[model samples]
Target: MCTACLIENVKSHMLSRRSLFSGAAATAAMGVAAGALSARPVLAQAKGRVVDLTHAYDSDFPTFDGKPGILYEVDKNFDPDGYHLFKLTIFEHTGTHIDAPLHFAEGGTSVDALPVENLIAPLCIVDISARAAEDPNAVVEPADIEAWVSANGEIPAGACVAMNSGWTARIGNPAWRNLPDGTLAFPGFSKAATDLLAQTGAASIGVDTLSLDPGNSPDFAVHYSWLPSGRFGIEGLANLEQLPASGATIFIGAPKHRGGTGGPARILAMH
Candidate 1:
């Protein structure tokens, strides 16, 4: 422990510390670079106008069942608490919502368990509005998918194939949910069309209507087949008309409640 010996030891310790810190800093910088690369596509997509595809619904929003989908009770008043809030009693399948596989299958993924990658996807809007305008029960048939592919290129893998039935325009009207005879009538996906979507490796199906199948449908064929097969569906989507037939990407902000069969979602579209 002479002075020179001690000084040399201290110098060695300082050099080791510098090396460690340099290595740590390099690792951190590499992590940031990787993160930026992964985020590029989403950030680039945001350059265009973002369209909200969700419908802001309330207790009165139309549902597959004719009951109220949500109920509200004031929990706090602004004058008294300096804030206002309402306790919400919400039904999972109400509003612009997602239908998880568990909605039908015996053993399936719940809303909280839906894959993160599947939630954001390329959007393919099949415009069946002309047919829907003529027939309330008109469905997006297999032919429509064919036409979509004819006009656009292939439906991207893991894309969300949505049926734009012009039905969102009817939301405020009784006809949106039912016909004059009290029978449910609205446009949706035919089983054959969904089968086509599945063949194309699509991840999800969507409808501007209340159900995946036509309102007058007696059998939930699409629901039974599609959900059990591991794909999900979105119902009550809005602003579908604002999107193009292809190229737009949809971001589904699904609810992550445990064991949720489905739940209200904030869906958006970006080019």
Candidate 2:
């Protein structure tokens, strides 16, 4: 039997299922409860993975205000009475962010307009850490994905593919930010891979870097290839090493900034 069927049978016996029909029903029930199967027994038995693909939000964290970086501010509210209150002033593309189609493409869906079903999906983590270490401007190409499939089988549809470049481990380091000509350097996806993913109709693409294109890119072809196709992109992801290549669901808890182009997001991957 297939691995899934075997897993179901094991789960059935563990749950004390007495018949084949009950086994099928148990599998269906387990699928429905997958998102919330973090109780003590399940956690102990299953030990599924959890990857936190969110930046640490703080007052002094670097955020994209307009050009490059901005920090948040706080205030003590004087609403006719002294009280402690706070405020945040950051750009839509700040920190770990989700790029709604409208971010780069005209007449595209905004964050709110995205379908609810698209909010959560499986994950495909491509390890390009070594290549990115050698060349900071390394771009993940279509051949990379093909090779991954050749080794790891097909990348499932409706999955959130995260390119692990280990860039998040270098966020605000000045030495790494400066290039030879006094410019920032980072890695992202090539237009070829972006186009291939768009053709595959993935719900979204993510990267563990500041942007989905090389830092010095002028045209942003990756955006052009994917955004216009109604697929979104997430940038500045963290903790990609904690996830497996596939079979994990991601939940993006982004603020519903109405009429906003893009915004910071809290992403959690559960396997």
Candidate 3:
């Protein structure tokens, strides 16, 4: 099937399955109220191994520019409330997150406005790890994309391209954020590469680092080059090494915060 047709089918399947679940939940609730509840599984378990692409959020997670990380407090405990509930204080951009177009572009789509179709697409991993190991500030260039295309065929339209610089290995360590001289160093996309991906009709771009642009970038050229075209970004991704160069399907489940420029997301990849 064509990429567009496959994407549409996936969307339709997702929506229909969601509706099925919702209906099942409602029926179960009604059954309990009417004393007709039975012990039977209502939904079939999904097949395949699902890989988590998100980083776990906690006080230890790295933040930008010395900013404070997540804070959690028990709002209610089983002793008093018959349930455990916690209150979380976190920034919208904390942990593994998605940056809507509005994150960098003026009057762009907010997190709530981002289409679900855009969040589900073919995943393409462009590995530049060896070069990144030698130079911490290595940026993915247009040549890298060309090399990827040469080996993996064309990057499908509406695909999410993830740059695997092997940076996730530094997560939770001080090296993930700042350097000795206080200059952040990490691999990210160059303006030329961002332009090439945008031209290819990519739905989104992602990186294992904290930002889509290099940590030391004075001007966020990559963000400017892509976000203005209504594309989104995913940052602080984990387990890129587990995904194949192609064929995996990524689903980004970002919080729908009204007018939010960005928000935490639970990204998953199904191979």
User: Where does the lowest 10-residue lDDT sum fall in candidate 1?
Assistant: 38-47
Please give the lDDT score at residue 109 for candidate 2: 82
Per-model clash counts, in order, read: 0, 0, 0
In the order shown, the candidates' Cα RMSDs to the true structure are 3.2, 11.2, 14.2
**Number of the top candidate by TM-score?**
1
TM-score, candidate number 3: 0.81
List residue ranges in candidate 1 displaced over 4 A.
1-47
Q: At residue 34, what lDDT does model 3 achieve?
A: 61
Model 1: C-alpha RMSD to truth? 3.2
lDDT top scorer: 1
Tens-digit per-residue lDDT, 1-271, candidate 1? 9999999999999999999999999999999989878655444445477899999988888877789999999999999999999999998999999999999998899999999988988888999999889999999889999999999989888889999999878878988899988899998899999988899999999999999999888999999999999999999999899887877889999999999999999999888
TM-score of each: 0.86, 0.76, 0.81
Better of 1 and 2 by TM-score: 1
> Which order, best to worst by TM-score?
1, 3, 2
> Candidate 3, residues 96-144: lDDT per residue as tens digits?
9988899888999999999887777788899999999888888999999
lDDT of 1: 0.90
Q: What is the lDDT of candidate 2?
A: 0.76
lDDT of 2 at 69: 40
lDDT of 2 by residue, 161-189 (tens): 88998777776664234466767678889
lDDT of the structure predicted as candidate 3: 0.86
